[model samples]
Target: MAEKKWPETWQEVNPGCIVFRPGSSRDYHTGTWRAERPIWDNSKCIKCGICYLFCPEGCISEDEEGYFAADLNYCKGCGICAHECWPGAIKMVGEE
Candidate 1:
């Protein structure tokens, strides 16, 4: 009897359909599909983490400087981060 060999990594698996593995999506960068991008203004940011709370993708993170920054590699540019910013720190700019 022959045994099936499973893929060791997510990238090694077939890409035909969606695979529901917890935290597996982190291995793939979905930001390539974004039409617009978010730009953060540090001067206006209050470090309240409002953008981080509202981001559906959870791509926003804090930097070494104690400021919240978005991971554009995984951000879809949905603008939710910008919309939720009370201090108008995040701005959604068109991708050109």
Candidate 2:
């Protein structure tokens, strides 16, 4: 019998079936699924980097001014960053 050819990547898998792949989430744009998005209040932000550390999607990045901002392209808006922020710099707002 011939050896079975298994899918090596997420793309190779059939549609509607998600294959677990290491670091493969970056290839897909899943931010649109978010009902709410994070907004940063720089004035209240302490630049402690707490939001960046708590972001589950890893979409938060330090901007030029040293404040952490979420990349809307990949941010799922789970509100984790906002929930974890102690300074109340990050707020989750409903997406209009």
Question: What do the candidate models score in CA lDDT, each in turn?
Answer: 0.82, 0.84
lDDT per residue as tens, model 2, 8-27: 46655556764556676676
Candidate 1 per-residue lDDT, tens place, 22-89, comes to 68667679989899999999999888888888888888898878689888889898899888898998
Model 1 lowest lDDT segment of ten: 1-10
Off by over 4 Å in 2: 1-24
Model 2: worst 10 consecutive residues (lDDT sum): 1-10
Compared with the true structure, model 1 gives a TM-score of 0.74
Give TM per candidate.
0.74, 0.73
For candidate 1, what is the lDDT? 0.82
